[model samples]
Target chain A: MIDTIAKLNGIIQILALVLILIRAFLVVRDLTKSVTGVFFMFAIFTHLSADMYYLIHIAMNKGYYPPFSAMDLAALGTYLLFGAAAHSLFPERTGERSETIVSVCAALFAAANVFLWGYYSGAWFQDIFSGITFIYLLVTSSQAVYRTGALKRDKWYILGSIWLTFVAGQVCVPILQNAGAVLAANAVEWLNYSLMFGTFLWLAAKVILCARRTEKDQALALSFGLMCWSLCTLYMCAEPFYQLALFGETFQLLLMWFIIERRVKTA
Target chain B: MIYSENIFICIVIPLLLSLLFIRREGFRFVLGLVIGMLVCLLSAYISAFTGTVSEMGHEQVAVYISPVVEEIMKILPVLFVLFIFDPPSDRVFLFAVAVGVGFATFENCCYLLSVGSQSITYMLIRGLAVGVMHIVSILFATIGLMQMREFKAMSLPAAFGAVIVSITYHALYNLLVSEPGITSVIGYLLPGVTAVLLFLVNLRLRIRVKT
Candidate 1:
């Protein structure tokens, strides 16, 4: 069963990687149109390289490697790049207090991870860096939704809640597994999948609706990108969750395409 | 078995002397080169200590730890310049490239000493591949930070994000090249491909900004 799932994961990763490459080319071809496009391209490029690394590892049949590797670092890079994309896309209209609140939350998240996971090595380093970027992304996307005035904003808040719950579930799975709570870990793993699937559905609906609207809303597209980013971070931590992460990546690439397509249309 | 310090001293003296004649951005460039070499040495010490403490094998250390240590060390000077000197934003790229060049040059020297420079083709490949990899990785951070600075959205996350991008790229290269066969070939070519892509993007972005 596990072998079948692993093979499925590899197949889907290759599929997603191809999609990402095509999207990257499209973004780069039209990149001169907007500064935000450049950052988005970088974000996509990181995902491409990271996914390529994993695929190559599997192809090489190199088994039982270190727990932390290029994929972890690349995951961190992907989040950071998305955070950059958000920063470049949205204007910095939020006050310093909001920034501070986000920073505090990020710190608390890091502290919690350390308390749970232990400050060991590369994983810990990635966790702290991921923590900061994660919080920044959450705040920036929420802020984009809040300020865009196009979406209902309440739906975004709800989406945010679901995504956070999924992340919390992901963060707990390893702890439970490590503590020999195998059944509990499996249960949470299922719960995480449901939450992520629902989140993707909600986001897809949001993207389609926004596209149907009369006005072109950049923030809505960017928020969708950022939300998908939140979903994509955990594949490094959980092996079973790889398929769902690829689903999230598909959503992200489609979002990038939407943005580029919109830009080209407007141009 | 290679005496890295001797190589450093032999190269640094002339570079330092040349610095006396250079001025303005040229001065900063030479200074950046010198600092890059210095940081390369420091990174060796730090990675050595980290490897011992972590108890990982040499290959593991090279793939997992060295990139993080070396990238951070390489970027330290650029970060210092941004924070303290606050040189013109455009000049940051020069400092970044200089640091990467210096670090790569020193690293190549060490490589030659460790394994005699028997094959010119291999040396040329290393020079182009590893050298461009270093430059392109640091440029990722430099360009990201510059964009954030331009947008007035430069935050701690953005800065760290830029550095993390560099670290991850370096790690990916190290991981790929650490093995033999097709993976190593991909690793060697990755840098040049990325450099070309980034150059075009940077050029277009600059033109967009100016116009």
Candidate 2:
């Protein structure tokens, strides 16, 4: 049974990779006019790099740890693009000053990424860059929520993707290093794989939802996506922190979405 | 001098007083207090479970654990308010602010106790930063809930996204200021920026309501 589970886990990982590739291809194909689509193309590239890194690491001996990894740069670039895309896609719901501030912040992030890659020395620079990026994400996401009075449906997939990626990158990697219990470690690895697969599906769903929607529908879809994603986090991770981070927000997103949908539908 | 006793006086005492002073809607207020405290405890527990102990420093705690824990805890009272009271957006926002005030006052008290007889400048700064950050985060999370109500599918992601953003903001502030430098100055400025954002958002909501 254990062997079978492990085998199933391996199969799931492979399937997830394939799905990610397909989604990437689809995203690229759709990148005709929309800057957001182009941003997603960058995201896909980052996904591919991250997925390939895992595949290679598993296939070969573990070697090299630092800011120099190609995958690391890809991840960093993905975040920068994602931030920029989010700002561009969602115009300021308030005023010109707010818009200017957000644009400048995004611009600064872009400039920082360039400088970090080009001029900055020391591994700590990478850490600082990442830290700043995290903050940037936080501020922009809050602004998006505050302005729109609803979470974007696409953001659900993004949050899931980020949460899963972080779990794989930070938590699973560290635990795998320790190797105290093989069964538990394998279970976590499988969970990570499942999350990745789910994220891809969620992303695809988001695109479809986005394409089909009126403004009201878009809001509704985003809310539903958030609720489902949150519930998934609760069920899949079975960790309190995950619940706090994912589930709590999920409920809030659901509420906002419902309100907007009601208003729109009535109108 | 007040800093040393702030936790008890600010957090515990007010909480206790609310239990006694609140008259007309006694049960509701009590329920809110209970829910708020539970959320805090749960957040602390979740943080520990994730191995994100603050004492272990940033590497072990901030990155992997704190975001998930703190964000979730911040949302609990909002959930409770929705469940128990079924408040409209205005009432929901007020309840959120109340919960934030409770959480912030307590947190400030704890900080004051730890730091001891600090200068008035330090107290004011800490009060504004930490106190308001707590309120802003809760408000943002609540805004997410309000948004979710309007645009259903956006609910979970918006709420989670808000929490994640707030946690990241809090963590970055902590990380940057742990050392004294240009980064620290930026860190100090963050809460001020965050406070201004909160005020603007609140104003927007008020205008929206009036219109």
Candidate 3:
């Protein structure tokens, strides 16, 4: 089972990376003109870089040094670009003052998280940092939803509620684990993952029905698909089951594919 | 941060009492001065607070947090004026400059008060370095806001971009000054150089437009 998961993950990861590179090439060839599209490109690039770093590091060694690896830069950079993308996704132009605020805040937050997490050298520091990121993501996503008036539709609420539930479950996981309720913790985690999967499917459905044939829809669908698969791989993996590397590569390929599709359409 | 009733008595009350002495014509400048000091105070308090919250010590706080806090604090009054009164364009520049200078002066006073230094050389350096740095930083933000105002209305992005410029300048200055020797010398000279360049550019633009 471990070997199978690892193989599956490797295939997905390589495919994703290839797709992202192809999409980047298409973007270079004047495939899409959207600002969000450009941001998506950067986000995908940095995210893939971080994912690739993880894969390479896992393959080479056992222990990880957060600072030495320099993956946090890519991870945090991706988050910042994602924030910018969310803002750009809106049709309406934001006022200069607010944009300045957002840009500064985003920069500060990313810099602080990456460096602080790298330097802190404490157990659970990474998890704590991840929690902070999730909170930040929640805040930014809600702001984007509100600012873009994406909440006018009930789909946002549905996705948001499910996401919130999953996060809440994540928050409770440590407590459950620490209390030695391993089975209960696993049950809650799996339950939350199921909800998250449902939310992703819902989001992808919306993207398909609403954004059909567009690069945005394709990107969204591809991301959701990769994330679902990655989580599944994680579920199947154990201490010796190293599938994260391939899952990461698969992500890269999916984005590259989106880019290529846009190019072909424009061509 | 000796922020107590003593501060209220020494700074706030005296400023309020002095405000009564000024006529309506000079009242705005005085108000700007007092508000600028208050903004500086806020910057100190908030920077310290955030530094503590973020688990930063003195040096880290000074290096990382102070720039963000001080830049934001210095610009608050300008933001208020922009949002509330809708002051005329040229006059708005004057108001911003006043606030900047006032902020710097107050900050200088606080620094001297804390250090109890009487050296004229130190005062001159502090006046030119820290004071002018504050002024220049505020100017960057205000000018950005003003230019954006002229172009497409002061947007959040433009304002945020301005804040970024202001913070970057301030942070760079702080980091440079935190070092000793030549770096500190460069840091001290940097703001004055920037201000001169800015002035020359404005003058040149005015001349070009006149022709």
Candidate 4:
């Protein structure tokens, strides 16, 4: 079962990567059209880097940097880079000050990782580090949704739904697990995957809609990518939850296609 | 210090020969290659020089320092070209590739010198791995170059973006192969395989764009 889930996740990750690389290839000649392209590039590549780091960890019994594997740290890097990308996409909308604040916060997080690399020895610290990063992402992404005016628009309803569903699942699963309702907890977990899948689909719809409405749709695509990643990180921490990761990565690929298709059409 | 003499001889001969070979059809690529190799050598010397000054050991240099040094070295001339020629961005990518190819060729020659021609199979695989890596690093930077285009001019953020992507990719490759056996197997094939896959994707995307 673990192998099957991992294989599915692998295929999804590859799809995500291939889609972005295709977009990269398309724009390899002219990434100037979208400032967000670099963020997408960093996000995808770091993701692949993290994935490879995990593969090495398990295969070679290395990278167990006490409490957290190097892959965990790499995952943190991806999250921050995505956060920056999301904020950078809507400078006019998100405000320069907020972006600068996020940058400083992210820099602190990166410093914490470097410190952990040398001195970390406890899981709780790692978890708290990740949790703090997750919360920061949630806040920034919320601001992104508002800054992009997605909160007010009917078109952004799906994003709100996706975020709400993910948050509710996160809140409920632990409660159910604590109640010793193993069966109920399992069910909510599955629901998390299903709802996220739907939410990403919704996000995909919004990306295309925004592409039509905005001149800098790639920024929107990147912002969408950040939200998907944030949701995935929130839910996909354990192996059984690996299935949810497929959803976030799949959403990224879908958006990648939307950006490329939009670009080709406009060109 | 061990490599300076041979690397210099290697650079100077090619540099002089390329100067004479200017009328050749592939001279521009060779020029890119030799210049790239020279930069690669210069980068190595700089890193060596830096190593002497910094407290980090040689292992740290290989895994951490070399990528930053080599990537900056590899992209310097390309950046110059980008600024001076201001060719279409696509041409910039192509130019970067030319430099990558050149750098890889010289670096391979140096490797052969240090490690011996060895078994052709080993040399061939190493060549393929290093060549692909060199190309991909520049491509990674070029991809970074594309991202900053929104500003409508080359800027620090743009250059920094390019370096970050390039450095991370370079560092990732170094880390992956930092292990041996199974990790090495994937590491060896990864660059070459991915480079081909990227080419195919680009080709297919181009066709789709046309139709």
Please report the candidate that would top DockQ against the real structure: 1
In the order shown, the candidates' DockQ scores are: 0.31, 0.01, 0.02, 0.16
Task: Put down candidate 2 lDDT per residue, B52-150, tens digits, no spaces.
Answer: 333454444543355446656777768776767777777777667666666665555555666774599878867777677667767655654565454
Fnat of candidates, each listed:
0.31, 0.00, 0.00, 0.16
Instruction: Give the alpha carbon lDDT tens digit for every residue of B140-208 in model 3.
Output: 778667755654434454355455556656766776676677767978998998789668645654555
The C-alpha stretches of model 2 lying farther than 4 A from their native spots are A1-267, B1-14, B24-38, B45-49, B52-55, B58-64, B152-155
Q: Residue A164 of model 2: what lDDT? A: 39
Query: Which candidate do you rate higher for lDDT, 2 or 4?
Result: 4
Q: Sort all candidates by DockQ, best to worst.
A: 1, 4, 3, 2
lDDT value, residue B57 of candidate 4: 68
lDDT of 1 by residue, A19-101 (tens): 75555554454553555665666666666667766766677676655554667666666766676666555565656464454
Query: What residue runs in model 3 are displaced by over 4 Å at the alpha carbon?
Result: A1-267, B1-14, B21-25, B208-211
For TM-score, the strongest prediction is 1
User: Poorest 10 consecutive residues of model 3 chain A by lDDT?
Assistant: A60-69
Supply the DockQ value of model 3.
Answer: 0.02
Residue B133 of model 1, lDDT score: 95
Local accuracy by lDDT, each model: 0.70, 0.49, 0.57, 0.62
Q: What is the lDDT of residue A123 in candidate 4?
A: 53
Q: For residue B90, what is the lDDT in candidate 4?
A: 68
Docking class of predicted structure 3: incorrect
